[model samples]
Target chain A: MHDYTMPFGPQHPSLKEPINLALELDGNYITGVKMRFGYVHRGVEKIFEGKDVQKVLYVAERVCGICSYAHSSACTRAMEGILGLEAPTRVKLLRTIVAELERLHSHILWAGFGLHEIGFQSMFMLFWRERERVLDILEAITGGRVHHNYNKLGSVRYDLPKGCEELMRKNIAELEENLPGLIKEFEKNSVVLARFKKVGKISRKDAITYGLVGPMARGSGVKSDIRKIDPYEAYDDIRFNEILEEGGDAYARAKVRLTELGESISIIKQCMSLLPPKPAEKWKWPPIKTGEGFGRVEAPRGEDFHYYEIEDNIVTRGKIRTPTLANIMILEKMLIGAEIGDTPVIVASFDPCIGCMERTMVIDKGKKNWFTESEFRRKFCD
Target chain B: MKRSPWISHYNASSCNGCDLEILACLTPRYDVERLGIVLRESPRHADILLVSGVVNMQNKDRLKRVYGQMAKDKYVIAIGACGISGGPFHEGWNMAGPVDKVIPVDMYVPGCPPRPESIINAIAKLLEGLE
Candidate 1:
């Protein structure tokens, strides 16, 4: 009948970024979970208060590494809306290529992390190996691996280099050939299935109630993909199904992301072939003006939303709502009855990026103190 | 130098870009494992302490605590521009400083998110210095 507390992270190996979860345990079962954000806060919104609209796009892209292009595209979209400009058709296709490519890499990365959590080390290696090809395609087109900085106000920074499309097609073909087996292995492998199936179940009602987005909602059959509901970029022209699952569990989320890898690859191929036969720069916009607008893009995780208020061609205020922020509350519901061992995988399954989730700036009074773990333990425990 | 080196990774207020690339080093293509670099889940087992991102006020203590936990002879490699000098977030209110301000840095890998090949090269250069 006794419950004791244990800390999960700010620096635990299971977490990819800095975020703390204070777990209260009754025997081996997690009785309660308390999450603390702000470890990775860098005053991003405050930083956007008065910066020029064009420069703010660079700041926007850095909000999260994996979804850099999504953030940049959304920023430019919002800026374009403010200016009442429509980017060239070729530019839209180019944006779609990078956005879909970002999705491909981000989903594969998440799948690898999930595999790592389930103790499937080889699968982790295999997925990341496959992810390298995606990253190569990104580098070949955007000239940067992580922060592509590819989006400008009314156009992409660069066109697909000579032979880049062929390279992309070749890589996508390889990924398509290999991904089915990976999915099969995930479904058929006893350990992965046992660890993942119904472990972090979320009902449709609960998913809707929690306001989940992206795969988190779709996995539970909520039909919440922003791209499908409200198309952007060249998404309006693309023909692809919104990959969904009715499972509402960890396995379901994984399945949605894995299936989306194929969807993203297909979307990119379509964009490449459909690229308007004109220069992207021809879709240029007039000089900036004062207005307010909203930008939304379906990032690898979910719907990435950005709001901008411009005054005299300067961004007066900007707000970013990353998918991880929307999905974090579901962890409280999912962890209520989960075994303690399930904590890491459950948290990982949500793909929580604390840096992206927390955007506030708060001063810590005890910032100067440096206490070692043993010292803290000795002081607090003994 | 031992054929294999155990690496401990810490993210001190990073944007998560470089952290992912550090992870990519473990994948089969740019496999840092071939050079015998294993990512240790604990600081005590590490020979190379890999620090990513800028050190913020909230994380500075934990970063120092983690570094303190590593073995005495460990090499600390600061990965990405933020880890070196706070990158684009240099003037942010949350930044305490770069990773070097909190602990001694042995090598610096500069990139928003350095390529896996570049990360591998940094590790190789560090190992070469060990000789």
Candidate 2:
């Protein structure tokens, strides 16, 4: 076997994010993996400097479009904590609703991508089609599917749109009814199980040592959901079980996501049922004077934390630690010793937001040319 | 209707908003392919070059190369707030400026990052212009 180096992305279909994973291989097996990120870095933190505390929400959300609301929520919560203010009950409920809705969309989207990576095109299409329902519900409520910016410092920007409850009920009911079928399809499919089951195993010890969070950690048998541990918003009000799998493989991660999708629907139903009556008084709070704060939210991928430094109501410094950042470390670990052919499946299992992961520079080795999709496709197919 | 344009997407220096929306337009929901628009990774294989993000000095040369590599009669659509103007990140020293400063833009779709529908509409207008 000859020693070969392969660059995985910056622009490859297998990689959802713009990361370049240079795998040094001896024949088909990966001996070593070099990871490079920042291809998608927009220098958002640098731009946040000197912006008003309120305005930083926009920049923060832009950090990861898939997890936009989670980032914004984290920022707002951090700011709220700094100002020594707690959001109104109604506002907290609304935030929880939006956050859970985001999780539904993100997880479904990931499931779709995972299917697609393994050549299950029909499953991919079906999952994305279903995800559209979540997007529509989000759009109906916040007027934007991806970047809602609905979470403001003190409260949300707008009240629930007309028919919002009915919409939630319809979607949640539909999702709940359909989830068993989807799970059955996944379980019965030998190819899916063969490809994913125990493909990328992350042990409990390694997961804890890495400090991984979200479904990735839970998949590895680590009960570390921020929602369960640090119950925020309506999470405390609703009774829901944290989905877990002990396999810590690709299949386990997928199963965790699939189960959470069902849980998210139930949580949404509870929210709709417990939604408070429309308050007469508009929610308002005094602006910040001088304070620094940190907020953590469980995004679909994992725990997303935002730290902010405010001086005189203006953001002096803002730093966001997206779940993908934490997950990326674990992904590199999973890639080691895996067959190069399983790269896409391994990469997709992390559900990496390349938009978030592409923050590293692509170092040119000058030996092998930049990786193209065709070359990758041929290699994988072969 | 006669000739659907071949589109190429380039990320200069952006927050990925415009890029995701552009992809959304290409997906089954918007299905820009129905209009004969296909997202080609290679610039040489495209008819309409979709540029996203603010032009930074590091990426300026690559942007120009991609633009220059396109076949004649190719259209350039500057999508999103960053490409149309300098956008929010325009004031930085490292930023080379807006897409217009480096290349002639055939169309501009504005939004902090334009929505998928807006991107579809921009493509429709560009196709109509080509006809």
Candidate 3:
């Protein structure tokens, strides 16, 4: 029984974010694991305390660069609900198109990283090469790739650019053609299947208890999707199945995302076909006297929820709960009693967005002076 | 082709916009390693320091210390609207403003969070200027 504590990160190559995981090892087996965050805090939620509702939308979007559009959409939807205003049909459809596009790009990006984590460079490269097409489409439409500030308070800031529909159709066609081959490769690939299957198993019961959402929960046979449950934007009109897997392992999660990519393509096609004849003339930019609202959207990772309170047209209180936040809890649960070697794969499998997780800033109330990940884990878990 | 460049990243109290994009470049999409650019976590191993976010008092000293630790001939490429200017956090009581106030910057990539392509382009431009 060799008792040694191994520090995983705050700055580790395997980790994408500044998360520190303290693993108490019993000779290569992780007997106990603790996860700590907040190394990249920017006080985003605190800043939203006293700002105009419109201005707060901008700040909320900046909460996470990868899921910026999702956050903005959630925030705007909440604000719209509070103001009792519905965006024009055209605006709603456009938002859905952008969101589904974001999903396509994000899922591909995550899949590439998951492959890279398991020492699969070729798969990583291939996935990213396909991702570039999505980025090009986004850049063509929104004039920016990652953080497209396209979602305004009532409607989108920019409408579809010239030949945008044709461009989307072409990209979608390419993805549709190439995706089956990639799926076949992923299915037949021993390396991917061996590492991912049954690696990070979380039962459906535990998933619900730990509050897991999106693909992570769905992978465990939990039928929970914000779009299906809540039905915001054009999601209500679109006909697509929520991809799910009974096995709650890393491979199941990966499969869920891979299948959803096809669903995303379908959703996009529906949006394109159902796209309104013309953009809205003037969207409802109603005033907010004083009220509170909640908005939730299904992001690439999971369900992203934004809570906001408006007073005199200013955002008095705003709090964001990203999918990563929910998924991190499940990560800790899944990591305990697991081998140390599977750390990176398990962590990357959830597609944990550090940008979203670092929103929680702990003040460290002078108990230890140094708030290590191990200590936080012990405090929270115990 | 000859210069083996070492790059360090600085998070001077940012919203993690530029930071993610910087990492994106290191990934397969842009793959900065193909251009002989290596992202070193420590400033001591760096030939170029990439700064992201607005400089605030809390992290200002840490930023200066990291910059000072780097070896000479080190270039600074400011990524994102927040790094070049204060961005959305421009006017706050406990703010120190942009990266230029603390350290000299060589290039600027301007976007709320500049896309990975833009960052790759900026790094390319930086390498060209270095040559």
Candidate 3 local lDDT, B84-130, one digit each (tens): 87887776434577899988889999987887778878877888776
Candidate 2, A289: how far from true, in Å? Answer: 2.2
Q: Pick the candidate with the highest TM-score.
A: 1
lDDT, residue A290, candidate 3 = 86
Computed on C-alphas against the true complex, the DockQ of each candidate is 0.59, 0.22, 0.34
* Model 2 interface CAPRI class: incorrect
Go through the candidates in order and give each one's C-alpha lDDT.
Answer: 0.86, 0.79, 0.81
Model 2 misplaced regions, further than 4 Å? A357-382, B40-44, B55-73, B91-94, B101-104
On a 0 to 100 scale, what is the lDDT of residue A6 in model 1?
92
Candidate 1: tens digits of C-alpha lDDT, residues B1-131: 35778998998888889989889888887778777889988999999988998888888899989998987788899999999888888877667899989999999998888887888889888888888
Native-to-model Cα distance after best TM-score fit, residue B110 in candidate 2, in Å: 1.5
Q: How much is the lDDT of residue A135 in candidate 2?
A: 86
Model 2 earns a TM-score of 0.89
Q: Which stretches of candidate 1 lie over 4 Å from their true place?
A: A280-286, A361-382
lDDT, model 2, position A41: 54
Task: Give the per-residue lDDT of model 1 (tens digit) for A58-168.
Answer: 888888898888889888888889888787888889888888888988888898898888788899988888888988899999999889999888777788789987888
The better candidate by TM-score, 1 or 2, is 1
Clashing pairs in 1: none
Rank by lDDT (best first): 1, 3, 2
The runs of at least 3 residues in candidate 3 whose Cα sits more than 4 Å from the true structure, single-residue gaps closed, are A365-382, B8-16, B23-34, B38-46, B54-73, B90-107, B124-131
Highest DockQ model number = 1
